[model samples]
Target: MAVDQLAPPPAVPGIPLLGNALPMMGDVQGFLVDTYRRMGPVFQVRALNQSFVIMAGESANRFLIEHGEAVFTSAESFGGLDQQFNMRVHVLRGRPHRHLRKQLAAGVSRDLLAARWDDVMAVTDRTLRSWEGDPALPVVDRFQRLAADQLSIAFTGASSAARFEQLRSAFELVLDATITGKWPRAVLRWPAHRRARAEILAFAREALEQRAQHPTGGPADLLDRALAATDENGQPYPPEVRAGMALQGYFAGINTVAYLYSFMLYALLRHPEVLDRVRAEVDAGGPLTFERLRDMPALHGLVLETLRVYPPAPGSARTVTKAFDFEGFRIEQGRRVIVAASVPHLLPEHFPEPERFDIDRDFAAARKASVYAPFSVGGHTCLGAGMTEVLAVATMATLVRRLTVELPRPERPLRITATPGPNPGKRFKVAVSSRQEQADYST
Candidate 1:
């Protein structure tokens, strides 16, 4: 097949060097959607001397995720991540990627998570209690802190307040750098990034040393488990490898979980009816156990709906490795292919009235059809998906049951930031009161 004979997907023309870089940084989802409307599901857009072939909608999603490995590679797609951090599972490819994912999955396995249920509840309760005196608390900030503390406990066994702050700051910098794809040329030479990385590494090294000396009777936390993990050949991972894996897991859980918790709250507050139904389910169910969380259809639906509407990570990219024809267009090898959750989640074909937040929507069918991939799809699906859902449901149930949340500005829309994740730009303040206080006032 002659390369010239094959047609390239439509490309959005832009400046000579920068191309659509500015627009992409400004409004990534909007830019991709607009281009999709104009050029259909498969089109190309140039950004900073590179061209990306974006594939949207259900078919596009299936092709990009399920069948991606055959024609695409994750390492090349996420190459920029190397500049920020060591090669984590997300940025690894082929056999190494599979091995790393398998090792990491042990940390978030259903049984492991169930064992730590009490720890999760305790942290969440502590966080909520600390906010009791404040009449109006910023939901995002509070949740971010809560998530950092919870993850620190689950991943590292224990973390001081100072360590938690350091981890949060470091994760934020790495996340921002990866999303923007414009890190300072010197990379870790920047004082803040350098300091943050050093702190994270120091913490990881200290935790590893402690685990090695004590050899906790049982796996105390994810770090301990990773340290003791052996590959298929029964070879233990090096100390640095274990530390890097632990740090990567910590970074992954912190920001993503925080944003997910915030979005779930935002969605529930905006829809009081849904909130009431979820609370009723929680009350009737009694005790927010893992089983109870799974049993409550309303609460489960709300979490799924929140993810569908405001996915923490909106889109993912892959680098084409083999020439393939997709939907009548011939895509050449070495092109960057993007599959956006925002696109399929908002498609009228997959989701009728896609923008509307309806918990009762038929997500089961949509998921089976590959239209709703909030945690992503295919070979690289997030290992933390199950854990995040469980924790979010449990936390939200506790919130509704113990306290009443009142949005100070119900009329104001929930605005998201420009980053790939569903981070809110404005602070979400809710005038919260105890359920007992509300009951007494009503009487």
Candidate 2:
């Protein structure tokens, strides 16, 4: 590893000005995977005026995951977060990030979802009930609403659209402008996004005030536990920190739920045999408990396979605080980087018949070996990964067990909308052909 010269990563060929931004944005996964094939794991691409070094494949993944803390810092790329929120969870770096994660984990933990399992099922039931007479319903919208209601209830003890919609309305715009950087920076001042930002901050203030007064300690909701969270020194956080951190948990995975359900349902429509297998597995498994869901390999594989085929996000953006060399390429300090975390899913070396959707493929082995980390690993891993998985798996199971439906165009493409997060575009919808009665899972 010593004595070799390190050079800058190779850059993708692109026109002047816009650079590779158009193609990359138009078909991100395709562009990343294709460029990876031609340029190898370590390379460069420019988007608008911004440039990024793309790190991908197995070795690249290992380097990033194992040494991410040493080489990278997300605090800058997340955009004006400190001034607006007074706290950092996802984008903070080093000791601060670790300490905050430990604190926030309690509020956004998977166990919270388990404790509220009945609410999840009931929410699914209500959403399904709403789709009764509709011939064709957009799975994306239906599922997004389902996730919003469930998350709102889990975080704030409110599920009705009237209450939950307060958190969701224009949330995507605010998220894109503030967190994801999908929208231009100037978009933040657009009257609609400005209103959304104000509403969000106001909602957090009201929620904090209400929760502080009530403090009705039964099972702790997100805000209650978040309010009680302390630092590594056992010091309580400021009100702004408490509110911002807790609110992040409130609307974490609506997009994932929307896309996951849409793709899984779309796949089920295209492959009837797989549908039969899933239905059979679900029917054989009597109660839909958290423990039981974990044991069902068929369902687990289905979700995993969908992720492999259609990841909600192809990669994540970060800024390099320290220079690092990978595959003989020197990633200089202060460079923007895109970790194409899911790019390995396209490599046949890691996955046999990579295009084929075989749920039984040993993805567990790949995940165990650290060659397939969809939610990322290490200090900057997604805090709500557990919460997201539980919500997604349960909703999918509940959907499969309850009703039968049809996708009008099983052959329709899975066009992705990357803003807010990647979801199947509205054109991806299913026609409900039948219904089932409300379910009572508790005995």
Candidate 3:
């Protein structure tokens, strides 16, 4: 078979069964990019005794995600997500999945999100003001705190949201356990691992039980509504299912949101001019309100650009359930195909001057043409993307309006920490004030 006709197996030429596993396992993105450079966009790699074809570039990714939905299954892509959380329904494929997705979408409509802006901004303002005195706090942790708090408010009303501190500790343990477990040979039964897992389960159990028994009315947060949802047959979810949904809320909401906020802060620090430009746009609108925020294009560009440059979850994969042929090589059933997001995100075809960070570059036109998809694509596209974006924009816009921020020095070029994230060690110190020095710049 000609290599050009079918997808070539990700190029793994040497080493037997566990070919390229050791090197690739530790740094998946780095290994994928390196392999692509050494071979081509598509190549074969063996990890854990399995030979899987990895795809790169925008067209390849689109073929796998958008066009080849039947061949590649998200259930396989996010395999252990169920093991980590109880909300198996949300991640499940087919009828139940579609129904739940529709319900979630209905609940989180644009109008609902707009109505929640007051609460979102209130949480953001309070959180930012709390960090006023600290001129040198690590932005990652700070952003994590802010995001977690906002999520707490967004999901569980203001009065109930005060428990975010407790939730944060639980979430941290969950993230630590999950990330560590994903690494090879890390025993989940280890004492530290067991303890972390227990913390997560305990937190989920309490939150679910509390929300289930005592329901809050008026703009249902994720928790209250999830607890109220019925299965496909119009029956209440089983106890396990209910517990699963609650756990999913915590897992889905915290770490990813933290990553988004952290990346946004990293972008602001790295690109001072962009930050200043965004601040100018916000300042020209006068007082920070939900109405003005939705109109700020520069801030919108900042959010969009940040995600394009440093996506929180850099790669999303799907496994082949059926045998298929691509670029000439036979892709056997059950093999995984990883979409290399970090590389594709930088593809010059999709994003011109892919290496450069420029917000002025017109993405709206390209996005409409299916050139950009940071949230991943197809049925498995992120459900919380809309909420996360609104939160990021709201928080960032408020900070710019109410605060004067200055990076002591330009942030170092971000380095990958956990495959798809910026390591927090490279902290950028920024002096922040409650009031502006001068309103010289205007949008």
lDDT scores in order: 0.72, 0.74, 0.63
In model 3, the runs with Cα more than 4 Å from the true position are 1-38, 45-52, 66-68, 74-77, 89-91, 107-110, 158-186, 191-199, 406-412, 419-443
Candidate 1 local accuracy as lDDT? Answer: 0.72
Candidate 2 stretches with Cα past 4 Å from truth are 1-5, 80-87, 163-166, 178-181, 435-443
- Candidate 1 C-alpha lDDT tens digits along 1-443: 56547788877778878988877765465666677767788887777746778787677877866677788787765554454455467677677778888888877666766766677677777677677656678887788778777666665655445666776666555655554455544554688778777677777778778877887575556777777777556788776667777775565677788888888888888888999898778777546676666688888888899888777666777777888887778888877777775677776777898878988887888778777888878878878888788878888888877777788888887666655455765466788776773221100
TM-score for candidate 2, residues paired by index: 0.91
Q: Candidate 3 versus the native: TM-score?
A: 0.82
Best by TM-score: 2
- Looking at candidate 2, the ten consecutive residues that score lowest on lDDT are 434-443
- The digit string of per-residue lDDT tens for model 3 on 1-443 reads 53235654646765776567666544455566567667776777666545566776655656655555577676644444556555575347767887777655554445555666677677677777777666766676677667766655555554334555555654444444443223432454568656765666676668767876877657776666667789789998766666666554554556667777777767777788888888778767665665666787877787788777766555656677777665456777777776665565566766878768787777776566544666765676677788887778877877776676666665454444553233333354567777656453221
Q: Which stretches of candidate 1 lie over 4 Å from their true place?
A: 1-4, 13-34, 46-51, 76-84, 133-136, 182-187, 437-443
Pull out the clashing pairs in model 1.
none
For model 3, what is the alpha-carbon lDDT of residue 143?
72
